[model samples]
Structures are given as structure tokens and as C-alpha cells.
Target: MKRRQLVRGALAAGLTTPALAALSGTRQSFAQALTRPVQAEVSELEAAAERFSYGYQGQAPTEVLAELVEYFDEKIPPLLDRPQSVTARMRLCRTAGQMAGMAAIVLGDLGERTEARGWFDIAARAAAESGDQQLHAWTLARKAMVPLNYRSPREAARLAEESRQIAGTTPTAASTLAAAVAARAYALSGHTDKARDALTDADRFMERISGEQRADTWLGHCEQKHHVHLSHALTALGETRRARESQDRALALSAPTSSMTRTLLLIDAAMCVHRDGDTEQACRQAAAALTNVSAHYRTGLTHTRAMELHRAIPAEHQAEPAARALRQLLAV
Candidate 1:
């Protein structure tokens, strides 16, 4: 069937706009096409959904998550619970899992850990239902960031490890992302050997990203995002010089409107300076990053990174003017 025919059929079947599939940078594929065209519909449906999703890519996390969760609520129940053919079931599961994973990631960025965990649980179920090993691995890998970034990295290493094991040898965009996040978790946990292994794995996987993946979207990998994750991992491992290079690459590659990500990148850059014994300069840099960021895009992840930067300052330097400035700024 043509894309138009599929969209019309979906509407005839009581589904909403094609944009429903487009949200979450939604990438989907079925093991096969059902009588209902499940496999044949993923890429086209996702394209429409992107048109709907593209306008808000630069918005604040809160705004973006609201729209996605709203669409998910409207669309998921029938897709997931209603009776459907085998191929349709697999296709819907893949779609739901991708959307859920993206929601969970945004929720994590906002520091809504409990909510994010709930979404990841649903994504996990969807992945299982779809029997998509890569989706399942990606969901687990994305879940790791909730603890590592918003709470404690120590709590996240295991999830990352599981993702790596599942991603062993596959070079899908999702698997590459899992590997990158796994490297961060390992680095933060002080596991130098594991961190090295995961980082190498991420690099290896990155080289094999295929045309089937949507590297431009949040649902997939891009060279810029790869570097951003690298900066975080390298900083965690105290490889400051290497971290700086990655940070620079990420910044250069960043979209001008991507304020939230760019802001977080700036904070990561500040941490690189901290690793160099320039505690005072790092504090000033972080405070400056926070200062320039609009309140709209200064998400929980943003504050979390800045706070971690503050706490890492040596006690003796805590009384320094820049340190106090950062503390007072965050307190508000």
C-alpha cells in the first residue's frame, strides 16, 4: 500500500493523524507486513510523525514531553491492547516502545525520575511484546541515564552493562547509543577497564551506523551526540584533555536552537576545566553557563550537572567568590 493509503486506513480504523507516528523521532520496523501493512508503514508513518515533531525539537523539555505524553495517551491503548494481526501487533509494539523511550528520556532530563521509570517500564513491555532485541536493549540503555545523570551514576552501571551484552556485535543506532551511555556509567563508577571497553565498543558500533537508522533524530545516533556522550564519559574518567576535544566537537555540531542540549554541553565543558585543578575557573564557568541559559530550558539535568560541579569543588575553595556565586545562584 502507498503511504496515503496507510494513513487513510489508520484513520478509517480510528487512529488519529499520521503525525502520531512521527513524534519521538519515532523509528519503527516490523518483522513483516501484515494484511494491515505493518512493516511497510513504519518509515512513512515515522516521516509524517517527524513533520509533526520537528517544529518543537528546540523547545523546553517540559513542553516537548507534554505533547508526546498526550499523543501517547491518545494513541497507545488501541494500538497495544486491541486485537490485531501478528504483523500489526509487532509494528505497534515497536512504535509504542520508541515513543515511550523518548518520553522516558525527556522525563529523566526534567528530573522526573519516578515518572521516567514508569515510562521505561512501559517501553520495556512494548519491546518485549514486539520481540525486538535492539529496542529492548535501547530501552534498558536509556533507562540507565535516569540514575546516572539525575540521581547517582553508581546506581546505573548494571543497566548499562546489560545493554552492552545485548548490543554485542550489533551496530544499530540504538545499540550504539546504548554503548555510549554504558561508557558513561562505567566511567562514573570508577571502573576504568569497563569504561575503556564500553567506550571502544561505542566507537566500533558508531562506525557501522546504517542507512536504516535516523541519525538526525533523538531516537538515533549522530556524530554530535556521540561526542557529547564522549565528553561526559571522558570527563568522568578524568581524561580532561580528550574531554575538551569532544566538548568542542559537540558544541560546533550543535544546532543553534538546541538550547537545552547546548546548555548541558556548556556545563560538561566546565567540568572538563575542573579536572585540570582550576577549581575556581570551573565554578565561574558553570555559573556562567547557568546564568546564560533561559529558565525555560534549564532542565533538571542542567541543574543536576551544575550542582555536581559545585559539590566537586574542594572544600577550601568553596568559600571562594565564584563558588559562592554558583551556590547562591542554584539556591534560587
Candidate 2:
């Protein structure tokens, strides 16, 4: 019974918040049309954008988000509007989609759901324009994060499935992530069989990816990230033992200065521990997950996880040593 409650509660943590600024690039000046330099510019900017996503937790996410906004609303449009070679236009459009996707992530991290949604719409449109099936699926799957965190798991799962279908026989890292998320979302919605099936699908997708396949970039996915997603899904299904295995692997690969991804993995592991009845240990892990990072970086997403962890503790243990330690941080 406790396990069932824990599963539901773990899957249920979410929030709704305001979005980002408007798209401002439509009026920006350009070098007239797409050229080799324009292509190179997109490439360089994308590299920086990838690095930006991996920023340390204490880093100012607001600054990077503003930068992405600049690119999306100002820098990239000129390149997109002017005529170029068929191949060049497609390449430029893919870059635009990538930038839009990255921007949406920043907005989401900032708790700006509305802004994220708009950016995702731009990315999906860009994907269509670029004629990249992978990008289209990636956009769909990536956009699932907004609803996965802020709305219902059922809706999130639906998006994940759509992404998988569009991904077809050749799944990219992003599509693989969509499958992993589908597992978690299905578990949250009490579809045990479906959850396991989605997890299998995720594993299959993971196997096909190679080191150079653009995994975990601004528009990529990686093994460590896959493990984190797996841990969350397994934890949501009350499979603590399996969840811990994946959690340890994810933590092992995570950088010390990791951002939301690491924190989320820690919280999920702690929640799994909490479900297994080790309230003290769970509290400590959960508390440390928040404490290791600067207070300003603890967005609503992490805050909600902390609160959920606290609530999961037995009422009797709420005042216990580790629980007390965790409780104190909650007010911070």
C-alpha cells in the first residue's frame, strides 16, 4: 500500500509557471542570404549552445536562456528567410530547429512553461521545414518534458508514443529518451505492462546509438542521461532495487558540477529509498541533493521534489534526525 502511494506521488510531482519573452528575430538584419559563412555561423553557435545546456548548477541559467532568445528571436531568422541551395536551406533550417529546441529547454529550466511551449512550436515547425524526421521526432519527444513535469503523465506518454512512431526504425538519442520517458509516464499512470514495454523500447533505442551519434548535446542524448530516465521510471514503478542500479550508474557518470539532471537523479534515488522504508537515509540523500547546489539554482522543479520527499516520510519520523536535517533545508 505504501509502495502504491509512493509510486503515484513520485509520478505526480509537477508545477505550472509563466513563459519566456517573444520571438524577436523576424526583424534582424542579415548578410542578405544563406552562404557558407552563414552555415559556419550556425555550426559555431550550435556548439556553444550544446555546452550551454551542460552548464554547472550554480551558473546563471537566466543568462544562457537570454542568449538562446537572442539567437531565436534575432540571430537566426535572417539566415532562414533568404534563398540558398536546396541542401543549404535544409541545413540552416535544422540548425534553427536545434536552436529553438535549446531555447525551449532553457525556458523550461527557468520554469517558463508558456515560453517553452512557443519555442517548441517553432522547433517542430523548423523540423518540418528542414525535412529531418529525426529532428521532428526529437522535437516531439523533447517537448514532452513540459507536460511530463507540469501536467499529467498520460498526456506526456501520448507525446512520447507519437515521437516513437515518427522516429520509426531508426531511433535517435532524443527518440530513445522519449521512450524512456514513456516508461516513466506509463508507470505513473498505473500501466505496468505498458511501462515495461516502453522501457524495453528505450533499451533497444539505446543500443543503436554510437559515441559520435550526437548523444546528450543541445539536441542529443547520452547513456548517462538514459540511465537517469530509467531510474526515474523504475522508481515510479516501485522497483527500488532496479532503480538503485540505474541510479548508481547515472551518478557515476554525472559530472560534479552537474545541473538539474544530477539533482533529479539524486532525488529519484532518495525517493526510491524512502519507498523502501529507510526514512533516515532517504532524508539525508534527499537533503544532500538540494544542499550540494546553490539555493538560487534550486528551481521550482527541485523544490517540488524536495517537498514530495518530505511528505513521503512517515509522520512519526518527520522529526527524526535526518528528517529534521532535511526539514531545516526546506525553509531555506
Candidate 3:
């Protein structure tokens, strides 16, 4: 289907118009017909999903991610029941699930939390049917994040534990991802000891996995970004000093291309500094971050985090020149 038709279908399927508009950054034209059989490799879908994962870092349009999900959705059914395609079909389903999960993440980043939840369900079901345990675990972890970020930490922690259970003893990248989120949920809920233990588990699992693993899952290797998340959890738990240290490590370790991640970590760092009683420094840090953000990332999750920094500023400090600049920057 063409992009316009896909948008119409999404609306017809009950998605709000505003939500569709928020996600529409991809190209409008699709050269290949949906039902046509092509010699596409499973790796292509994996790669696409990986690219989509980094979309937050590089400012990919929400619409582009929507198109990717649509492409994967159309391609899955045609390849499902071919007699000799059993193995290929399984791989296809797993890839489709990963694509769906990635799209859901994008939607969440765009602040369309309700729609993101539905896509997460779609991804989890597809992954489960494919019998890909790691993918299933990843999907559950992704689902847990919806609550972790916006709703109840108790639910998020429960789902994260379930994801870890599904992951079992396997020390794959997916398991580490689950552990990291579980840590965050625990921290958010004030279970400091549990949060610390899960943080340790995440680090241990990450170390055990040699080389890059699960490049196809689109969660990417859990290294610096994992630490960045750890810092976020630490900040939530009021460990500002430790959080600042972790944030420094994450920023130092991250690739220069990961500006989005850097900006996010910077925002977290600003929060830490503000909590540490350096509101001027926090405002300066946030103002610097605003300079690097692209329009695509300016509105959703980024905006939310910026608002957090704004809120962290003391009422007395709000009129400071740096704080005034931060307010102006985030107003856009």
C-alpha cells in the first residue's frame, strides 16, 4: 500500500489523526507491491529495525518508523505458509516482531503512549508465535517500559521480572536489556536494594556476552546506553553523585554520532546537578543540549525530559539568565 493508503488504514483501524501525523517522517512512495515475492534477506529487516532503534539518536521521523512497521506487516502474511519456507517463515516472523517493537518504541518517544502499547502487544504476540525466546523477552521488556515511564512502577517491575524469567539463564543481550529495565523500575519504586542487584546483574550479563550479540533484535548492544539508563535510575533514587559519574562514563563511551543519546544523558545529568543544588549549572547543561537537538526529536520524549529539568529548577532560580534561556529553548 502507498503511504497515504497506509495512513488511511491506520485511521480506519482507530488510530487518531494527530497520532498518525506525529509519526509520518518516512518517504511517501513504496516502489514494491505488497504481495509481490522478492528475494529479500531476513538480515535486511533486522538491519532496518536496528536503524529504527537508533532513530532516536539520529532524529528519524515518526512517519518513517510507521512506514517500516507497515512494510513488515504487509510482508509477513505472504511468507507465512509456504511449504518449503518454514524456517524462513519463522525468521520472518521474528523480524516482523522486532520491527513492531521498534515502531512501538518510536511511538512512545513521540508521546503516543496508548498507540505504543497496542504495537507492543502486536510485537509480543508475533514474537511468541515464532518461539523466539529472546525476542519474546525483549518484547515484554519493551511493554514494561510503557508502565515504567508513564504509569506504575509496580507493574513495570513485575513485567520486567517476567521478561527475565523468560530470558532464563541465557546471558544474551536481551537478558541484559531486561535486567537494566528491571533495575530502573525497582529504583523508581524505591526498592533500592533490588535496583542495585539488578544493576549488577545487567553489568555481569553484559560482560559475559562476548562480541556483539543479537544484532537482529534492534535493542542494540547494551553498553554505554545501558549505563545511561542506569544513571537515570540512580538519579530517580536520589543518588545524584553516582548518577553523575555514570552519566560521565556513558557520555565518554558513546559514539559521536549518538547525539540523541548524548542529549538524553545530558538532560539526566542536568537533573542530577539540579538535585545536587547547582541549578545554574543544570540550566546551562540543558541549554547546551537544546542546541544539538533536531526538530524531529524536539517535541516528544526530549521535550518531556527538558520539562523535567525545568521543573527541577528552584522557584527562586527560575528567573536566572540560564534558567530563562532553558525555558525559552524548551518552549519550542
Candidate 4:
């Protein structure tokens, strides 16, 4: 069976558009065509799902989660019967876990506590099954963020501590994730010292990341542009000064390529300005951020952040008009 043929079969079997696009390169499209198959179509689908999840991480979580759920519902079940295939099952589990984590993040951002917890549970289970310690630790850290966002920093801190312990046995990427999560948890929990320390650890971990080891899962490019993650953590900590600094650093690093990243940096810069009481500058940055946001399939979290900023600016400010326009765009 040719690759296209297999893809057609998957599509006929209910694969989503993104899932089908992910399998565009395979020699044979369906699971039956594996001459020396190392993994199953479901596994490949899972990996693609993971990659997509990472790609939309900084965007609105609701949109990303919706897409993920659609893919899982349409594409995952068909591959479950092939459980004897270790490589396939492993891939599927890992992908499923990552998606669950992404979903948890979205639900948490939207203040859907019950839904967030359920997604976290799914993520934990999937991570355990896949034996991907990094994914496991990362998901746990994300789980911690729910409470932190909800203003219960104490519980967030505890979860962050647990994540840190789990990450200790993992690789640099996982460790960085743990550190970032801990930083946010500490910042929200009012442990400024611990938050700064965790941020430092996260920075150190990023310094050690190599090009070859870079993996492209759905959370942006994990290794190379870690400054964005740091900026996000700083922003969560209410250290707008540090967040702006980090955002500047990320922009400098991202320049000359990747419009998506640059737009995100602009948004972060805008948020920093907003926090600093410079409504004008903040509105300008938000307007610039919308240039990119308008062009892409924004996730729910990004939209919410934009909305929060929109609500924060005073009507008397000169930039209110622009801010209002941006908010209107986001609403669409």
C-alpha cells in the first residue's frame, strides 16, 4: 500500500485533517502496509498530535484542546486493537498523555477546575503507561499551574515540588519544565526567593540544551527558544520588569526568523508594559501582537490573556481605541 493510500484509509476510518497531514510522508499509509514497521499509524498519529499540542502551547488552550479531542476521538480508537505493537502503543500513549496535559492547561486557564483535574489524571495515566518521565514531570508541573492560576499558591507549590523531584531523574528539557513550573508556583504562592531560584535553574538548564537534542513537540520548539518560557514564568510571578527583560531577550534571539515567536514576544512585552502601568506602551504592544494573532489559529489561553489586557486598560488612555479594536478582533 502506498503512503497516500494508507492515509486515505485512515481518513475513511475517521482521521482528522491535521492527523492526516501528519502522515503525509509515510511510505505506506495504513498499518497493514508495514513491511518492517517500527511503529503503528496510531503511534505516528500520537506523535503528530503531541507536536501540534506543543506548536499551539502559548496560544489559546481551548482551540488547541478542541482540535486534540477531535483527533483523539476520530483517530485513536482504531489503533488500540493493535496493542501488541509496542512501538505503536508507546507512541500513542505518549501522544495521548501530552494532549491530556495540553487539555489540562486549557481547562485550568479557563477556570474549569473539574475538567482540568480530569485532564490531568488522563495525562498522568498516559505518561505512566508510556514511561516517558519527561512528559510525566511536565504534565505534573502543568497540573500545579491550575491551582496557582486560581490563587491557591500553596497547593501549587506542593505540586511544583513533586514535579521537581520527578524531573530530577529526567533530561534537561524535563528539568527545565520542572524548574519553570516551580518558578510560577513559587511566584504565585508568594515565595519570591524560591521562584527566582527556580527561574535561575530553568535558565541554566536552557543553557545546556543542544541543537541535535532539540525535539519538536506541541509546546513550541522546546530547546532553542527557552527564553519565552522563562518570560511566561516571570510574568506569572508578577515580575513584569523581569518578564519584559526576558521577552526582550527572547525577541533578540528569535529575530530574523519565526514570525510566530516574534509576535508572542510582542504580546509578552505588552503584558509587561501593562503591568508597569504604561497603558499606552502596553496597548501598542498588544496591537502589534494582534497582527500575528489575527493571522493564526489562536488558542484559548492567548485569547484570554489578550482579553485580560483589554480589560485592564483605562478608557481615558490614548491607546484605548487600538486596544478596543484588538479586543474586538480577538472576540472573533
Candidate 5:
């Protein structure tokens, strides 16, 4: 199916949040008058492309994401800078911002830090121009993940706080996003209690977020997936026991579907087990995980997790075939 058809399907399927409700009524009216059926096809294609691009994240090859990013980068600028109709410009800008946010995430996942930062800045600018505070906040929160990954937890915390402040009273998705980012920041900064508190706040916010709550086009993933992302952040902070517990909860909430995501999680689980001094099990899981990594594109997140598992194995244990295999995988 075409990209636009896919986005329409996603919207029809209720996969998207209602955060754009405030803008939708006015934009819809304007869109109806200014845009022809032919233009609608283009819009739908743009939205669908973004949706598929985001759906494959953490699971697809880097080249796939790179291709999507290039497509958006080529397609959106002209639409935003020179819309065929004034009435449709706002809607186009909003959609462009959402696509930009997806690109940022893809770039970050692929370890293209410089390009990711640029894309995130573009997304923020597009959100501002479209007057969508929710999109702005979501993009900012997503951008904060870069710092968190780089071990700059303080910077990540500041960005998360900024996002929360800007989000104001419409705190459903934005607040949840901010809380998740803040939780990771606190954990990385060695504020365990604060981290736990932030995570609790995130969970509470998530509970209150019903299907009818506001939504951003760019933040279209399932709410349950946030817990899995948060669990990984906890693992990064060295809270092995908590990370394991959270991972179990996340897995119970949603089964792994993507090879890359499953491999990454398995590696994480191995790290937790290794940290807990279960060398035998860690080696087994790590070896199993390594077998899958070759199937997908390499990502910094996965590489780092694999490195952790590699370092966790004791020298004596390294002599085992499984452990030796993991070491060889990391070396490559």
C-alpha cells in the first residue's frame, strides 16, 4: 500500500493520539476548502511514510531509516516553505514537524548524533511555527534522549524539565514523555530516589492517558511501549534488580515482535543477570542475543549493551564457548 493510505489506516485504527484535537477542527475546515482530493493523497502519503518510518525504529536496518530521512528531508522543506495554498500551510507544517521528529529518532538510533541534533532542531522549529505546544514538547523530550545516552544526565534532566514547563496544563503525553526522560536523567545522575519518583510519576501519567487523550502525530506509538523504554533507561543506570523487574513487567505488557528490539532486550537481560553474578545464565543469554544481532543493522544502543555484557563476564568464565563467542561478536 502507499504511504498515505497507511497513515490514514493508522488514524482510522485509533493508533494515533488526540493531542491535535485543538488544531484539527480548524485545520480540517481549512483543509477541506483549500485542498483538493489529489492533494489529500500527497498528505496521506507523507503521514504514512512517517508512520512506517517510526514503526520500524529500533527494529529495522539503519539504511531503511536513512532512506526515510532523506525522503522527508527532500519532501517537507518545500511544503513548509512554499505551500500551494495558504490555508493548508499550517497543516503541512505540523506534518513536517512530526516527520522531522521521526527522522531525529532514526538518526539517533543510527548513531548520527550531529544529524540527529539538526533534525530535532528542525522539528522544534516546525512545531513552533505550527503553534503546537504538544508537538514541541514531545520533540524536546525525544531530543533529551541523546544527552541521556551520552552520559550527560544533567543536561538531559534540564531538557526534560524545560519540556515539562512548556507543556503546561495539557500534560497527558507531554508530561509522560517528560517524566520518562527525567527518570532516566535522575538515574544516570545518581539520584536513585528521584529517579524512582520520576518513574512513578511517569507510570501514573500513563495510567491516566486514555485513548481519547490528546496526541501528537509524531508520538503515535503504543503507550505500553514507554514502559519498555523506561526499563532500558533503568538498566543503563546500573539498577540491575529494578531494571530486571521492570523488564519483566514490560515484556508481560508486550511481546517482542522485531528482531532488533528482541536482541537488544536479550542483551540487556544478560547485563542484568551478569551484574547479579549469574555468569552462566548471562553467558547463555548473551550468546543467544549475539546470534540475532547479525540479522539487523548495528546500533550504538545494542553495541553498548553487548559491550556491558562482555565486560561483566569474569576472565575465568570467558574461557567458555558462549562467553568467547560473545567476545568475538563484540570485537566485530
Candidate 6:
């Protein structure tokens, strides 16, 4: 339940905000269109996308997403104008959107904001074309994170609310995700009341989710991630006590191999502890969290949060080995 699952499933790559983005490439003409990809081809694409979805959470190399971006860009153009089953075309479009979204995240982490926004725009369009409200909603929700990361919480809240409206009363993971991100955005904007209400809505929506829905899409599989976002919103709203409690719950509920998420939650918890006046304890906790995580596992968002935690510490304590070590870890 790290940042990534807020839009798709699982934690988004390391310390960065877990929002989805899209890509832009030179427009391809429909003159080379094929009827549709064969079932085997579709299956292969699905398998690859799913594999990349899970791989994004751990130490999966950025190259993995890069390759997916290239693959989808080359493959999607030929299928755009082809006469095929509605189901098949939708599947293709959805896969392409997912790839574009993943690519956007990778590009953002690599410090390419303009390219990332282009990819995010493309993903949103593809999702809309697929007529998948869940996909469209989640993609927009991910785009909201860009504004939040850029310090435009008001805009982020607006976009998140828009995504929530698009998600409607679906009671699916996507709707829950939209609500959760809205909560975070509201908290960041200092609208504590709105944030709390959004959090309540998110919790209620998650309660209604029954069987698997949209399991084949990146926006699915986020049952436990709800708490992760809730924790972040709580933190931003100055509810340190509740924020720590929520982070503990998230860590306890998360899978063991989810080292990235564990690192994120630990960092959040450490901040809460620091807010409570246990400066040394907070420093120690943060240092320990960084120690356990591999360098390859850190995300831009996670690093952002870690830096915030470091700055929160007193200047005198900043020189302490624990604090210094945490800073060094993040610098890498």
C-alpha cells in the first residue's frame, strides 16, 4: 500500500508520489492498420503488462518500463483503425494506456517532466477511448499527483475530485483510489474537513468491494493501499497521532516482500514520532528504515518524503549520526 497503488496496484516505484502519467509520440497514420492482434498476441501483451505491474513495486529496473513504452508505441498504432471485436480493441487500448502511464512515471522519476505530462495526457485519452470508467478515473487520479508534487494542492484536489466524480458510485478499487487521493489533496490544501470527509468516503467505498473487479487492469488490487494514502492525508492535516496509527496498520497489513512500501510507511511513522517530540527516536527510526531498503528500491516520491523528514529535525540533531546517515541514504 505505497503511493503507486493509489492509481494502479501496489506501490509506485520509490519515494515519489504515486500518480499515473502518459506519453506522446509522433502520430502514426491508420493506413497501416491491421484487423486486430490475434488472441495469442493479446495474451502475450496482457501477460507482459501484468508482469511489469508487479515488477514496478520492487527493484524492477527502469529499463523494464522503457521497453514497455517502446513496445506499446510501436504496436498500438497499427491496431487503431483496424476493424476488430470491440472487446479486442478495448483491450488493446487499455494495455497501451497502462504502458504509457507506467512510462510517464519512469520519465518523471528520471527528471523529464515535459515528457511525463505528454505520456499522462496520452494515457488519459486512451483510457477514455476504451470506455473504461475505472481506467479513466484512475488515470486522472494519477495525473492529480503531478500537481500535488509540484506544490499545487488546490489543483490536485480539483483533479482528484474530478476523478472521483468520473468513478461515480462504482464501489470499486478505482473509486476508492480517487477518494483516497482527494483526501490527500485536501489535506495538503489544509482543508482538513474536506479531507476527513473524503477519507470517510474512501473507507466506505472499500468496504463495499466484494469480488475482484477490473482485475486485469492496473487500477485494480488496491484493497490495502487505502490506508497508506489515509496515513499521508492524516499526516498533512496535523493529525500525527492518528497518522502514526494508520501507518502502523498499513505496515502490519502489507506483504513482507513489499520492501518499498515498508520503507515508506516507516518514514511516515518516523515523522509522526518526531512531531511528538521524540527527536532522537525519530532519527533512529528513519535511519533504520533507510538501512533496510535497497538503493534500487527508492522512488523520487519516497526520497521527497525522506528529505522532508530530515528537514523537520532540529538543526542540532541534524548532525547526529542517525540523521546524517538518513540524509546520505536519500542522496544516493
TM-score of each: 0.83, 0.81, 0.79, 0.66, 0.76, 0.79
Q: Is candidate 1 or candidate 3 better by lDDT?
A: 1
**Per-residue accuracy of model 5 over 209-311 as CA lDDT, tens digit each:** 7663423223742454575667776786777877777667656654455555566667778877877878877878877776655555455656666776677
Per-candidate Cα lDDT values, in order, are 0.79, 0.77, 0.78, 0.68, 0.70, 0.74
Error of 4 at 318 (Å): 12
Best by lDDT: 1
lDDT of 4 at 325: 72
Best by TM-score: 1
User: Which residues of candidate 2, in runs, are more than 4 Å off?
Assistant: 1-37, 40-58, 314-328
Residue 178 accuracy (lDDT) in model 6: 83
Once superposed on the true structure, which residue ranges of model 4 sit more than 4 Å away at CA?
1-39, 50-67, 81-91, 102-116, 146-155, 169-171, 211-213, 219-225, 235-242, 252-264, 274-277, 287-292, 295-299, 306-332
Q: After superposition, how far is residue 249 of candidate 6 from its true place, in Å?
A: 2.6
Worst 10 residues of 4 by lDDT: 212-221
What ordering of candidates by lDDT runs from best to worst? 1, 3, 2, 6, 5, 4
TM-score of 5: 0.76
lDDT value, residue 21 of candidate 4: 72
After superposing candidate 1 on the true structure, give the runs of residues whose Cα lies further than 4 Å from its correct spot: 1-56
Q: Residue-wise lDDT of candidate 1 within 141-177, one digit each (tens)?
A: 8898899896577668888778767766778877888
Could you give me the TM-score of model 3 versus the true structure? 0.79
Which scores higher on lDDT, 3 or 5?
A: 3
Candidate 3 per-residue lDDT, tens place, 173-250, comes to 779888989999999899999999998998888888756663422466556766777888899888988888889888
Q: What is the lDDT, from 0 to 100, of the residue 118 in candidate 6?
A: 87
Write one digit per residue (lDDT tens) for candidate 6, span 187-213: 888898999999999888888876655
lDDT of 6 at 108: 59
Question: What C-alpha lDDT does candidate 6 achieve relative to the native structure?
Answer: 0.74
